[model samples]
Target: MRILLAAALLLTSAPVLAQQSPAKTMTASQDAFLRDYAETRRFMSGRPVNPRITPDEKTVLFLRGQPRAPIQTLFAFDVATGEAKEVLTPEAILKGSEETLTSEEKARRERMRVSARGFTSYQLSEDGERILVPLSGKLYLVERVSGKSTELKTGPGVIDPRFSADGQQVAYVRDNDVFRLEVASNKEHRVTTGGTPAKTHGLAEFVAQEEMSRFSGWWWSPDAKFIAYTESDTGQVEKLSIIDVMHPEKGAEDYSYPRPGKNNAKVRLGITPVTGGKTVWVQWDAEKYPYLATVMWPKKGPLTVLVQNRTQTEEKLLAVDTASGKTKELLTEKDDAWLELEQTFPVWLEDGSGFLWYTERNGGPEVELRNADGSLARSLVKPEAGFRNLARYIEKDRTLYFVGGPNPTESYLWRVKDGGAPEQVRPGTTGEAVEGGSVARSGNLAVISHSSPTSMPRTYVVRGDGSRVGELPSVAVEPGFVPVVEYREVGPLKFHSSLVRPRNAKPGQKLPTIVEVYAGPTVTVVHKSMAAHLLSQWMADQGFLIARFDGRGTPMRGAKWQRAVHLDFSGVTLEDQAAAVQALAAVVPEVDLQRVGIEGWSFGGYMGALAALKRPDVFKAAVAGAPVVDWLDYDTHYTERYLGLPQQHPEAYEKSSLLTYARDTSKPISPLLLIHGTADDNVYFFHTLKLSDALFRAGKYHELLPLSGLTHMVPDPLVTQRQHEWVMNHFKRHLAK
Candidate 1:
């Protein structure tokens, strides 16, 4: 299944070229562009990513890589002087040795879709004096005052290392078990025992990490007295082996994978003291709410956990009593469809007054303040306020910072203070259109990262009164050209749409178009930022127009819009793509209706293949990459949430599956190029093979390309460049005017 994220084609019965562009060698500029785009991770490198303000509000910490490299190093920006200093790098710690990754670390990186090396992540101490940087499986503690780092005596293969609240000690997972190490003395204590490959402690289950985005399974108490962690038993789950086709001699790596109707890993939450005593298992009805969605250990409130039922339509927020191992129900959220998890919520106030919660009860998501007992205190953000997620809550002044805007494509900084209405936060505004912005606030200080259609993301430090302080430095390379994109709302439903044409196109030219689509839940593709269209513009420069949109079954429009594909993935998703293309063509005559193509990856890959099979009148050629052929082959959490149990709603799976269409000989299959990574553990390569086999048996013509040793993400820059070239050639051959 697609991670609710990221991205053309033509249709024909047999391979026939009509007015196809001449096959030519790459130009110097084009070759340079491809290399730079792939190597820089689509121009995202060297950006101050994941910025966090230190507790003292004196420095802002971020990770930045070389302008053309993927490896990131930690940097600190002195807020007072606007000076940036490198804190740590993998090279400094490794002393010129090559960085190596454990099998566990590789799997974790795949789950997180992280390709960067060096310091991919770090943990900051609460006191803001020290930073914990985990590099290639080892831990290093870097002091804020001195630019020196000390390697903790803990053994290698550390997975998730976190700092205790007091910064005196550190906790991490190694060999599937939780361990604690005193920072000063290096005294280590095993927090849990009897951990094996099948039964692991202090780690999230596959579904939790891949689907729910809950990367960590352990939490430290505010007082640093206890550690709350999860024990996951995956003995009942089916073990699937993924072989590295390029290195088969290394043997297959077997992993516990739960399909749509299979048994998931049994996970239990437990709390143990830092001194390593008996674990107190939190009490809850695990049989009903089997999915542990989120865990919160706030500074002033009881430890809280959010759990969901198998269907994901119901969930509960329970506050745990550490002493008795008991839990009290705090809140219950239900939806006819799957309930979306809010990443930041249940923020307990320092004064123990109430907690902030995000809910979709008012048609769209809004913020609400709930009493300590979980009853509603008041609605802070209503449906019309365009509330997104809570960014921060300053307890001293009782101010809430959030992200939202007038439309789904826009994200602006918004704030509410002292029971006042939501107001737009225009920090150092000069009337330029800030397409989207995010706030990283600490106390009265904030770092606003805003972007527009013409520029890359720019960061500004601001005072409490919205006065500019200083700018965080970014070394990201400019793509050298602003993407010429037109945002539109097409179709009767007003589908959020975008169009990109060649920069030098003639006014009356009806260009062959490629409909780029994800059409998946939990993500929106049409955005107001220029970075979102760099690749689109590059593709358009290859003599084709680009049309993309967020159709039904996408988020931010409300529950009903997102749930449109609940039981009909292929039908609704493909229908929306075709309808959106036609609707856009009606208003924009430059979009050639007779010469159109479609392309996508993951869920979009599924849609691309489905379109060629069902809507040949629309999409002429398709490129399906790492596509899910059948819903039953996908994981339990994501698949079942939309299609229900395979045992109960087999029809939904059958109707939505490409295999169902491959078996039917009523129509000729449209031209297709199927791509899959042979070692993809997420949507396994078998999905593509099975569909190819079915299509071949049914006498369908298609092309299948297997990427050897590649996981779900093909992160290698050279391979990425080659892949895009193949896609462009395929589109040029089939989508010609």
Candidate 2:
């Protein structure tokens, strides 16, 4: 069933290549120029490119694509020999069925189809003998010499497979339980058992995966002798059920989610031996440190676990001796609001006596080298003013790469040594270069660079001294497609929007402007990048002016921009968006303010609902999915960060809630379509339910799309397609007249 869903998402949309220039094609001289450009661009852009250097610094691996096919295959380039060889090919992995399959089988096949455009997680073995690839819930081991691949296991719902250092074992998760597979014997053994329903083992819930940015469940130790994982018990969490009314076979699903100020999932850490035995639970003093953010295994003998308290402001890094189970506090960090958890994996030093740490304590984020005993070795990458967040750290050479925004709307990449003022690397005035990844081992460098308003991704290789070596070919863009019409406007007539305009736009045609918003404190909507969403483009192609802007409360800049919406989240974001729209309407006469529409999911959904009610003069139509109407109904960790506790700030919470303004929406205002999944745990399905009831009692009319068997993150492709189609139809009926 999961495979079918995955296939549906993959096969649902076909790539529509825009027309390219004839000169865009690479010439012999142009190819050489591109090579140099890719190299120079890598250093200048501060992005990870090709020729990925290994920890040992001797070997380098890169991805090479055939110009004829749409797919890209992985290739290893030996810098020493100046030669490149193809390592993995789709032909080698894809086999069995050659004939055109049935519609159902085609759907399944599409789900299984791996795209070169999509990111694939591949890790080389410690010995560099084989590579582990997780494909379609199955682990595949590919030999370097013969390119021979063998499926290790085909378990029910398996992901995040990691190879042991000795390359003798492979560990993965199945049905929320961690398991280890013996390579030679092909035997699977469960390391952790007893997974309760709605609860998870070695993995995070949906909200944590998306909002908190957690993916992998289990972590391999330095010596590969033990594994540490997290367990979440959601039995006490609030349960929301959804019934899929649109499906031919109606089914119901119940999701346990912790909404704001509600019960949360209890989390704990445990360790298991690779050879298979009883797991040991790591005990923690709840009063001192209750939440487990991350656990690091600096050395095999003693495991260092970093735990954050329930308040999230205080963090303690505890060194637990695996032999005696004795724990000692190594370091502690605190903040007024909350300390940002190190979402990425921590890099341990060679000797394991100390490790690298990053903190946003002194106004902005900075890197600090700390000993295992918890004392700070030195402060690295300190800024005199403004906020700087460490993006990546190349520990081998003691260099740190970071993203800094002097202001909230703009961002740039900067680099510095272990302790120094960061030198600006990728300096830009308008759009931001979204740095993907950086691989700097043994002085050879590579970076992936892409900016807003461009679809092509360029790769570059740099030297140890930050000089360009060479550049890879540009990502092929379809030919003949030209963007001419301006879709949306912002600020004033001088400030033209960066939204992609439709090529077939007619003159004097006033298109309906659809605003996509996720007005939240933790995130921002505006980012300068060429990475386009297909759905956003589809709306534009259907003759809608799509525009998105980050309201107050979004991060990335300084405290003022983010804190502006504090204690007034919903109202502040809505007002900013409303003002931006009014300004845009005054400048861009092509946009019909009377036909303006807004749509969003989650926090954005909440904003859309509020905008339609609060600023009926601007937004004529709204589509909200899984919205939070009341702040009191949401979870503690997120809501408390902004509005404080409901008990402490009752007036603030009441004013910010959409439910308070629902009664004042008697006037014939914008038409609204509220969609929600019954099993939504994050925002809770009750938010929509209560809003629907409130509107009905107030004699207000609105459309409701209640789905069953769906969670906060809608999984069904059919439902997603229907949702978008309904939104487009609504805009076409009202805006495109």
Candidate 3:
């Protein structure tokens, strides 16, 4: 009777045990790493560390411990005296009866809970006595010493407020027009008011900001005499319509957005006096060159503006005399593909002899000391063991900091004297060194260390002599957080990856796996930072082994790693990711090869589609969001740089495109889900539409999720949540036994 009852129980529970048998338990070391990893995540989210040195160089401000709820208040560590103070308390910002606030006020307060979220533009005064904060689309002056704050202006779309050199007056932009405000008298005057519906007087359009990374459109002269601004006429550019559903009436909003080989906004440099009135347009012969790269005011001289030709192969650093309106070419850089310009203005030496310039003329990216007249003083730092790109320059201390890489996955911090041999500052460290802004006064170097994976960022202070002073107070790991089990332990996964196993995993159990990928060149997933990556963490918690790997073409490694994608955008990167996945599967027996899933957004979406098409056997399911299925469909500047001219490398472009493999996608592929915004300008909705048509013709069954009236980035939180939910659902449906 007992044997018969046991047989009945085994028969009843066989399916449930089989389902639970695949989850593999982590090892002791892995378990410890998981605990530490969890602690690292908690510590990072709770206590953020950033190196902040005073302008006098007498003190370094470091934050310790996490603030409660709103995250506005925390302990600030003063490096000099080793004293900590609580500053910027949440209680100061919160209204009376925080729970009883209006919905709008509550939303605003909640927005402040996330650091660096609410403000569109923020700047500290020269003396750090006051903070110029952009709130509710206007500028406000908040005293650091006293908790008092005053509204600076209430105008039409204000941004980029800058205090004059004397800190007496503030210059900012209002609806593309430049405005100057007196701090004490509260007097405001319109400096340049010619910005009409078609023409912008002192500010650039959306495309310039999104593509060129030019956020602020103006700069103030060191003498506080003139304001240099860019007036972009976007009427000539292509108009893209975006729908606004939040309005009482859902309607289309039209804006000019330039795509590749399309007409771009004609931008011109203009200088205006602080006293107010008209702006003098910086004269440039239209036949010679038209595009402006950057504008800067160096020392008390004329405004220096960097201009590039339409082809983007040649760049000229032209100094425009504000008084005379005469322009002279200070320096010209030419390249085979496209000349790279420094995003920030050139650092001027105190002596005014010249400035530090970064160029890639000698095979690889290097730094050269250019005289005030733009003659090369010397090549400060050149590539030695590997390709080096000057990321930042500390002019006061005569130190040049850069990221050099033997390969794309690994990067190291390197420094060299203004005219000395390059040396690895941090040796044998596998992580990338993120340069904090140069301390203007002390000439001390501040950096944040990051690794490919399994390493969190830690701030450090280094002297100009290549000696480490000490690590600044960093995020403390929480006691209960576990790393190994909660995070992926994939070795040297190309470009770094973090894996997470289920909490209930047992020894030798095989588990289905999912990979979250973003193959964009601009962003790196494996950086050594404490970011709340919700998708991967959520998937791991849901009993699926999840992984994230940054393929080649990701940033922070240096020139070669980024430039390698040139002319072969998706091919080489996809190959590296596939190899990494296979390597991970081989090492981790619990990764069930038959039930693997891959997903990404934008460029990542492009990669996901390619992965499923190229290696159907490896990736069982794929969720691609707003993917650029074809290189021809993407914008010109970005696509042409990486994939070269479509006319030049037709075969390479075709091979890299997922559309080319549509006919060959007859394998027993896992379920594929394609999502896109209907009005996506960056990666057009047409990309998904064309792919869907092709897939249908190929007799493939795939899910298509279209977000109506959405742009390139779906800003609606509900839509974003739904997208994540769809991805999770796809993974659960395919990867689950």
Candidate 4:
């Protein structure tokens, strides 16, 4: 039965992914497989992303595609009336015009992995009366009440357009220069003149966007008088060329890419007014701390910015004086490992009396409500060391909402009222055993999305009093198959692990197991949402036991656990995966540890490749997709934060790199399949070529699959589905012993 089920899945799957793009002449079964897989992903993840409730809580603004349509449209959901209506659509706005994106815009979306066509993002005004949507270099402002939109006509190649608090003016960056457009006059005013070929007035550099999550470089003052933006100069940054082999006529595009140990883009902060005035440069020691992590201008405090050193070990929350442009340190946070940067809301209290900051300076990760002058008043939660965060505060109940827990696998929604004890709102949020979903509150209503491994996602509208109003109407299609999976902590380390057996498995049967892992910092293997692990479930349905474990170095556990990979990414991460397999096999007896294999992409890909080379006794066969064979080949921001300066610590760099271990012939070799996209600029397809070269030199024969015109994160739904299916077939071929 197991063999037959695997054969059925492989009928539409490729035994070996063709080097060329998937042909259009696929069989009916293959076409149907791709379509079903794509639809499942599109629907299971839910259509709406970045949902925002208006300040009044009367309506919710979100972006979703129209009824499984390719193009996404802006929508507004009326809470009182319980009606969802489309505000704007791509067809209505484009009006048959060709959609052409500037290179900068394309890079931004690529970093975000945003595939939705039309307005992928929007900025809600402070008053919640307007939203600024930038589509294909053009700006459109939509009124909430009237559902009317008018083109701002800011300028060519406009990006990062934001609205002032009063909604009377808009500050936008166009072609590296800052420009302000007054709503009433419909006139554009240039705010800065110093931007040059290598410098930008208001834009995040590549590192900031890709690693820091600081998407926009501009911020508006609460009084709607001044705008604070970053000045990025990339003259010192190194450049890398990316050429599309498919279109040689277009030639290579050279972009400023700062690799490990290379000079990063010089950054500075400047303040400009809406009415147009001289730019006030914020004074800070840029040489000591080049990375600007976060910028905040809360309603109740001075402009605060968080800056970090190149190694990311230390950070300072500085308060900048608007008049002199000089900064004073509010607090400093230092860690033996790299400091983390998070996007937090309501930096200040309601009256702006004090500020709320989340950091590890207090011995563990927790939120702190400081006094007006930056002195710690008290810790929001007790001295428990676990993952917790400040989401937002409910004014009516005086409750500060947060998400996290001591268990790394699971996180709960908790709230604290006026420094009282913390209350758990959603107890069962861990990916292991899901009961409820994550919650986000706006106004008097909270938007709740719930799901489990065996169920579809359901988003509900809940009142402030904890009563469900109704389900938010979603047009997403349901999945073709339901998932059957279970969670366990089989090791003494209490490893948060999961095992997805074949949905149609017999009562007592042994099965070949494939361990799917990420096992790196800031990435979790277990999530409460069923849709999050859909691919793993699909792999399980194909007659192999799919396993995932949030091993050491992953987030949500505490400072100690997350920092275990401080300088050694190859050791703890791999050992935990191997141990978990043994532990799970001990518990379930039917899990065949001898026939075990490992597979993953990116960091997980690196892990899979390492297991195949270093631990062949454990992982017999591996699928390494877009693996980073060397840490030195990655960007400076992400790599340096972990391994430090490659020049200063050459030995550490050598030990951390997978190429070093590949040369060791005595480690034993296993069957390995290397997969990568030619156009993957992030991991750089060069890593795969180098690894393949190392394997060949070591006299190890391995399979290689190269994808054309594919970035690190392939955006096409059809391509993603087929690519995953092909990988499943590869595992079946080798692991189906």
Candidate 5:
């Protein structure tokens, strides 16, 4: 649950600066600092994203770009030829005109946090003959031979264009309607025409895209005979206006935003023919199971739809009949806390007899292969490490490739054969044929990008037996500095922590400390990857000892650890951070407890501000960026999932807000700096204003830095640098005793 505000320069991997056209606003000193502190060049280089191995396993396709040259270029890595060729560039796609995108397109891109231009994503045809790419609200077909693109003359606002199973037809959304085009004849047909200003087809609703991780409203059936798509009516959702005060001429953006306990988008599933015909409505108890989580259509089996209730505590996996639009419940999972959603799941076996499901049914999360009738076949993974994510399900080999590590700080690859117990594929390092250590597999050939805390990440092409074929050429330039990190679990609560000390510090030298934390339920702060803590490394270079912890509320440990803070965000998260500090001080021996500071964004921001106001004895100074002062202001799915209905759980709502403790003059309100962007739609700027009002009423002096036209994820590098400098100075003023 990273709020969009952290989008700018996320890690060393996703660098924000463009090398082809670097921003000239950076000062020479700032440039030098960027080089010496953490080296932004490593981010720009070696960023090979969306690596998909070709079906023939002879080559791999990936998107690459750099700072100054942020517009991505599609490239192919020859498995045997050992040649890397540029497929197409954003310049080639745009030709000469500047990009003109629709509001709908822009919203979807923002939801994905798409940073680069050209081919950010693409879909290979089932036959592996061609690729389909949607760019600038239009569709393009890329030829495998010459890499030349042929723009499909589809109507405007074409998005999520995907090829049908056999690659004869393509389906996409235009305006709000779903449309399909024949590749050979360029014949286009409208699948649905009932989309109105309040109702839409083919495009995912707000909550589905933002929270549920289901980006599209449409799913194509196996035979390409019928298409299943969601129709959403946003008429009931409340509209919130987000205006660009930086440039008043641009006016305000009226967005349909659903806050907690409010009406979410009304969605229904329907099926239509590829040649365009009457729609068959899929019947379900919509009121009971309203949240559509995901849609998976097996190559030869029934369509699977995952749905959840408004509270998100229970989820249902249903198998739908394409012809009659009838669905039967395949499985149901219930949790006291909200059920976790995976980006990839409901893996159907190649033969279509059973499907693999990720669950916590027996003590912890694991992969369970179940029959079509919902009977368990076998458990694919041991719960000790806990199931993380599915990497590649090699149907031909009947092997399930996935990732999970014993500890949250590290993740490793694993595989299981025919519903058997899983085993580590390539252990002894971080990074896998998965994300963080991204892996791409095709025909038993996999290209993996991996790294560790002390090592620079690299790319490797390996075979099914885990033997390396060769190394993929990486354009990455290694950073000048190697981080000195100590990964540990602190406190009786067993909080996962990463500590970085100043390079020249002596063993017993006491130093002012900054506890950087994002101790939220949604994401972890400490990870095994080197890219995870580059910011902390840079802060450590500034002469302050930096420590971070993933305490009770964070995920990946187990449901119990995560559910500990179910309705009590304030008590569990902040207490764990404080406890970690105390425990670390006892173990490390040089922690300057008297001059400790806290800094974080979003949920962590709330923690920092709350600490300064209520627990100032421990946190001497704080930096709160885009803090959520009141839980009531957040969107429905995310807020209610943890806090429950605010009306029913009034005490929980009251107990969690920073405003509840704003007037607590317990410790003279330690130095606090509140930073935010006025145009942030996710957390909203009003949160900070509400906190400021409360603090001002309490006669607490604080600093506020308002960015005019930025969103939660500050995409602009200059603003990011300024914000970083602001936090450093604030810490220096109060914590450097």
Candidate 6:
């Protein structure tokens, strides 16, 4: 299952440096390294991303931008010759004009957590002849051979545009309705209508996009004869307003946000002909399984849909008959906790024999080859392999590829032929590393993006046998210094732990420590890559030590380790972190228990607040950024999965809330600082206000820094640089004694 909670902002993607206009004083405290870190987007800018290998595997197309910038332009890399050149640029299309976005486009980007501009995403047609690029509320089609970008004239407000399987038609959502365009004639056809704010068609609901990571609500059938889409009604869901308090005159924007146990959006799926006809509504047990998690229309099988219960413990995969809109139950999965939705599954064989499924039904994650009737054929991958996710399937040799490793700190590429024992796909060349690599394959070619303890991430093109072909070069500026890090498995839990120390640290010198944490689900902070600890190293160079831990509830462990956070988000997460730190102090003499501070963002933010309020004896100070102060206020899908309904599990909600700890004044509180963006929509600004209000009423002293006109992600370089400066200063004032 793919669950997404925000990690430390500095560790994730940041916006380009050119987007924000900062005040003069913002850069006054930034050293050359800090400035470079922010400006280069944590050294992510100028790196190749979103690679699409053509069907023939003769060329690879990708998007790249300027150094320290986020405006991506399309480029084509020749596979045989290893030569790359620019194909399309926003400047060429706009004639040096700035890109303007409609409100719909802006909201879509925000929900997807996309911070880049100018071709942030693109879709390549199956035929490999055409590319679809959506920008500034319009659609542009670029020819791969001619390098010509032609505006489709689909008018304005176009979103989620994609090519049909045959590449003869284009389907997109505009103003909540679906529109079909004939690629050859430029003819437009309306597929669905009667869309309004109360009920929208061909668009994903807020929870699906923000939480489930399913951005598009419409999919084309394999033959391109029909389009399956979702119709969502939020009329019964509660509406919450997010106001830009910095400018009250601009008014507030209201959204249908479903809280715990609240009425969620009523969603239904339907099929409409591309030639235009009445919709055929697909039928299912809506009351029993309300969440439409995924839909797939593979070429060799019936149309399949995955649906989940409101509580998320049970889910069913159903097969559909398009002509009659009838459904047949294919499989049912139940979990005591909650079942995670796999990001990739049901990979059908070419002859419609069976499909590959990833599941934890066997107590741990494994890959099972299921028959066409959804019965188990055999287990392809076992628990001992640490099967993380399926990478690709090579039909030519009947070989299956996946990403996994025995250790959580590293990921390796594993390939098996025809359900045989999996074997590591090691580098065929000497001194080449594939550890911590993710695979993207096309025919006999594969692109491995990887990094190790000694280097930042880089991408390489290789043949099927893992022989290096060439490198997908990166223009990222090197962070002038190497991170001095030590890795260990600490405590009885064997938590993955790492410590970043100053380069000049001497023996027996105890230093003030900062714990950069993201002890939550769906993310693991400590990795085998040096790039993972770059920010920690920078913070350590400021005369302090930085520590990180991936404890229970974080991913890459077995189900038992992850489900421990179930029903106890606050206690379990904080307990593991506090214990890990205490255990580390015992083994590492340089760590001073009395001089420790904690900081995190999102779930990590919640952990930080929990530590500051309840475990002040361990943490001297804390910083919580974009935290969920109360579980009751979070979205339905993510919250209910762990804590169940707030009404039924009131004790769980209270025990897991920072406000519950804030209300208790019997114990001394640690120095606490809360940071949030005023315009944040995911973890709304109200979360911080709620906690501060509770603290004020209880006479607890704290600090709050409200970032004006920003969202959950502080994308601006100047602002990020200043934010870190403030964080370092906070730790210095409290932990440095």
* Each prediction's number of clashing residue pairs: 6, 35, 14, 0, 18, 2
lDDT of 3: 0.62
Error of 1 at 527 (Å): 0.9
- Candidate 3 C-alpha lDDT tens digits along 241-267: 655333426566465656655666787
User: Who wins the TM-score comparison?
Assistant: 1
Candidate 5 stretches with Cα past 4 Å from truth are 1-31, 35-46, 395-397, 419-421, 430-443, 665-667
Q: Candidate 1 — number of clashing residue pairs?
A: 6
lDDT of candidate 1 over 1-737, digit per residue (tens): 11111112222233734433323534567668888888888888888877888888888898988888878999888888989888888898999998888888888888999989888998888888999999988999999898789999887899999998889989999899989999889777888888888989998889999998898889999988899999999999999998866566888889999999999999999999878789999999999999999999988888999989999999999999998889999999998877878767778887666799888876888888899999998887777766776778876776778777658887777788865787767744332344333454444677788787787888877776667788878898889688998998999999999899998889879899998889999878888778888888888988889989898899888778888988779877788888899999899988898889888999988988998888888888998999999889899999999998889889999999999998888887777888888889999999998888888888888877677767789887876887787778788878874
Provide TM-scores for the models: 0.95, 0.76, 0.77, 0.92, 0.93, 0.94
Candidate 6 on 1-737: residue-level lDDT in tens?
A: 01122233221112322222222323333377788888888888898887777888888788887788989998888989998888899888888777988766778899987889898999899889999988788888999988888888686889899999889899999878999999888877888888887799999998998878788889999999999999999999999888876667889888889999899999999999888889999999999999999888898888888899998999988889999999998889999999987857778876777778878887678888888889988888887777887878766677778887668877877787877887767644222233534444443677777777778877777787788788776777877777877889899989889899988788789998899988988889887777788888878877788999998898768888899988888877888889999889989999998899999998889888889999999999999889999988989999999999888888889899888888887876787878888778789889998988888777777777777777888778877877787677778767877
Higher-scoring candidate on lDDT, 3 or 5: 5
- Which model, 1 or 2, shows the larger TM-score? 1
Q: For candidate 2, give the lDDT.
A: 0.62
Query: How would you order the candidates by TM-score, starting with the best?
Result: 1, 6, 5, 4, 3, 2
Clashes by residue pair, model 4: none
Tell me the deviation in Å of residue 278 in model 5.
1.6
Lowest lDDT 10-mer window, candidate 3? 1-10
lDDT of 5 at 609: 93
Candidate 4 lDDT by residue in tens digits, 695-735: 77877767777666777876566566666766766777677
- Model 4 bad stretches (over 4 Å): 1-34, 39-42, 66-68, 383-389, 395-397, 426-443
In model 5, the worst 10-residue window by lDDT is 6-15
Q: Residue-wise lDDT of candidate 5 within 468-505, one digit each (tens)?
A: 77765666555656678888888887888889997778
